[model samples]
Target: MEWGRCSEKELKDLEAIVGAENLSTGESALGLVSRDESYYTPKIPPQVVVMPASAEEISAILKIANPRRIPVTARGAGTSIEGNPVPLFGGIVVDMQRFDSIIEIRPEDFITVVEAGVGYKDLNKALGRHGLFFPPDPGAAATIGGMIGNNASGVRTIKYGATKDYVLRMTVVLANGKIMEIGSLATKSSSGYDLARLFVGSEGTLGIVTQATLRLAGIPAHHSAAVATFPTLQAAAQAVFDIMRWGFSPTALEVLTADLVQMLNRDRGLGLREEHTLFLEFQGASEIALEEELGAVQDLCQEAGALSFQPGLGIDERNKLWEARYETYESIKHTHPGADPFVADVAVPISRYPEILEYTAEIIRDHGVTGYPFGHAGDGNLHVVFMGDASDEEEWGRIVRANEAIVSRALELGGTCTGEHGVGIGKQPFMEREHGASLGLMREIKSLLDPQGILNPGKVFP
Candidate 1:
């Protein structure tokens, strides 16, 4: 598809809609929105960047761009690991930063209305006062809009679920500059199509979310954490499968390779055991219940050949432990300075968790690549960050091959190419393999919603 260049008249019209201050054709602004946290290089910079403060402003901007076939990519905090927010066609990028506002918090109703650009941490900090919080952690300080676009989830997803589960309603600005609101506040709906959910993981390909009403979860009355070390990565992975199989529900269950643990220790002063480890957290209403659950988990880990089981951490220690876990990606990056990360995010059935972990290890070993394999093990999600200098074609070729091998194995094991990270550019090759004929239906929906193909052009479809 040929994309139109933003002429001076179009630029002035957009500026008039959002004011000169909110719109920019500056090189720095275009550069900032041109790329995300992904390793993908920015090939073409956007022609203009506009920070639309309200839904109406976004609608007006879309109205101007949609008819002209100018690509409009919505950007939030720009923290996506995949290039989900990258403007590949070099048109107009709608920066959602100005939409950061917590509209309302109805604690009694267990819901919060917020603009798309509110930071995840900032929203939770405000919710903590009311004994409530949003569950999809996603690690980074990502904006609500970005999370919705990618359906982002993190360690907490094992129990609470992803961003899609929490999203109830959203005010979206469609490609034709029409303001559309989808979803209901009711807990259960027997109503028509679930359009709200349709847009949740669309990655701004369908529409741009300006505001969202999310379902809030109450804070647990009690919390407990434990650390279990195993002699092998497979052992820890097996324990994760067993814990899930035997009906042990953990708030967060993470498995880390020894190399990753060492990196965390060196980078964050964590001082954790430099062995394959499983980090587990349980939330309950009573201390006795938590103790019983921890004891059962210990037995499962022991049966899987655990070297040590340390349970019952204090609040301070628990906070510190999770903080370290949340910074795993950063820790890996810091360990290999000047190297880019090619992260493989895949998920399989719980029973196939151990097999995938073992297979990933073999691929890394055979390729002789520096890879840190770790992830939300309880949910059968595996992440391996292959670090290498992108400029070195031979070395990076090995990394690419290793990634492909792992993803192919995951597909063979009834898994997906990406568990959390959306398909921006990196995983586009696997979309057909993973989705099969259903992918054709997805394309149909995209075409129906965005006939002009102006919304987030050159993404999702292979």
Candidate 2:
């Protein structure tokens, strides 16, 4: 689609709706909207970027977009690892940054309503005062709407579950300017279709999420952190399985391989080196309960070949420990200056996690690609990042082969291509390999909701 073909009158009206200062067709602003955090960059740019403030305003913009057959890509913080916000098909980029506001905070009911643009960090800051938390932490300070769109979860997910589990309801603006509400603020529902879930990981292909009501949990009375080292990655994974089998749940259970530990130690110099480590954090009603959970987890780790169990440093030190995990992309890029750290976010059944890790190791060795493995083990998701010098074609080929092998192994082990990250353009190609005929039904749903294919085109379906 050509930007020149878009109606000037519509642009003028949109500028009026959101002040002229908010509307931008400038080169610098357009470049920012052209690509997301995806590995590959496309040259596409939106015809105009519109930052609307309310659901009504979004509906009005959609009325303009639908009538003119203009593609509309709804974007939040643009922190998606899969290029979910990139305007692949030139059209209007509905920048949702202006809609950031905490609509309501019901501490009594343990829920909150927030606008789509509210960042996760800011939300946590606000919730901290009420002694509550919204536990879907996706590393980056991603927007609530974007988190919901991607069904994002993080290490904290082992206890609280993913974004979809806490999302009570959402107000969405459809492609054709129809506004609808899905789900409710109540705790449980047996009402009907559960349309809210359908849009949770829709990646903006169906409708634009304007607002969300999220469930919050009261802060635990006590919290503790621990780090256990194992002889092998398999042992670390086995420790996680044992913890689950014993029916004890830690708030966070993460597996960091020796490679990842070395990367962190080399890059950040925190002296964190262990063959395989389980970074565990426990939260409970009392210090005694937290201690019991810690002891039980320590025992399981020992049974799984733990070389040593170390208590995590104080709060600040513990923060430093987890920071390395979150800044993995930066760490990899630093270690291999020109390498592209393309992430393969895959999950396996708990029983098959060890096999998947073994297969990943084989692929890494066979292809000679640098692969870093670490993720939320309790949830069975591992982020395998393939890095190779950008200028080396031979190395790039190895990276591709390694990624293919990892995804194939994951699917073979009754796992998913993604656990938290949605199937944006990066994983769209594997939809058929993963979902088979169900991919066809997904397209039908997309068509039924968005006939014009104006809402985030060139995504979810290859």
Candidate 3:
């Protein structure tokens, strides 16, 4: 779709609504907000960025933008790997950082009301005071609203479930400038329509999530962690399945390959090599509960032919170990100096995970390039880092070929092109291959919610 230029009238009107200081058309500023951490290269800069301080202001901006046919992409921490923040058509970027506020906490209800810009670290910090916690922790300090928007689930998803599971209510600003309240504070409800779920993973294509009421969990009194080592990648993956099948539930279940382990060992002095690792975290109210869980896990690892299994670090040690998991992007980039990498999120059934990983490894090996394979193994989501070789065009071509091979294998095994990362522009072309006719339904839904094609245009449905 050809992008229409921003009219003088629209710019002036937007400037009036957001004030001159909050609006910017400068090249550098627009370029910064025009794209995110996705692989898609920067294209045309957004016409301007408008930082609205409140949901009311957002509604006003949307009301004006809809009539003028201006594209408005909502941006959080700019950590989206699917190019969701990239403005394919020159439009307005709504900076949501100013909306950061932890509005209220209901300890009895186990729900917290927060604005769209409240970061995960801050939310947990506040919740900690009340002996509660939010579990939908996507890496990168993603905002609560953003997590709900993308239905993000992190390492703890093995037990806590995804963002959609914890969301109880929300205040969403739709594309047509309408403020719609979906769901209720009640834990269970048979509402007229499940609109909350629609916007949860809509990726801002449906509406701008301005506020949300998310469920929280009581802080466990006792917790235990373990780092299990295996002789091979397959062994580690098998250990995850075996441990899960034995009725043990850990708050977090992660699988790291030898390459990633070596990287961690060298960069962070983890000394975890010669074995694929499973970093497990168990939460309970008593030492016995934690010990029993870990004990079961240790036996399961042994049954799965683990090279060795040991208890996780103390509180301080566990925090340091998990910190490395959050720095995966930087670690992978460091692996191949001078090479830019695009990460892909692919998830398949647990039974097919080993095959998928083997296929991905073969593709990367055939290309004669290095890539990191790691993700939440308990959920079967894998991250394949595709490092681009700047010096050789032929090598770059091989990397693209490898990506296609990996994605195709995932689709064949009932996996998706994306697991948690939304399909921004990076995976648009594969929508047909992944969803086939369902792509039409998605487009139809987009049209129904945003007929003018103004809200996050050129995303999801291609």
Sort order, lDDT high to low: 1, 2, 3
Q: Report the lDDT tens digits of candidate 1 across residue range 1-462.
A: 678888999999999999999998889878888889887755666899999899999999988898889889999999887788999888899999999899999999999999999998999999999999999999988999999999999999999999999999999999998999899998678799999999988999999999999999999999999999999888998899889989989999999999888888889888888999999999998999999999999999999999999999999888998999988888888888899988889999989998999999999999999999999998889999899998899999999999999999999999999999999888999999999999999999999999999898888888
By summed lDDT, the worst window of 10 consecutive residues in model 3 runs over 36-45
Please report how far candidate 2 places residue 73 from its true position, in Å. 0.5
lDDT of 1: 0.92
In terms of TM-score, how similar is model 1 to the real structure?
0.98
Global lDDT scores for all candidate models: 0.92, 0.85, 0.83
Return the top candidate by TM-score: 1
- TM-score on alpha carbons, each prediction: 0.98, 0.96, 0.96
> Candidate 2: where are CA atoms >4 Å away?
1-5, 390-392
- Which residue pairs collide in model 3, if any? 225-312, 226-312
Q: Report the lDDT tens digits of candidate 2 across residue range 184-241.
A: 9898999989999999999999999999999999989877898888888888889999
Candidate 3 error regions (>4 Å): 390-392
**What would the C-alpha RMSD of candidate 3 be, to one decimal place?**
1.7
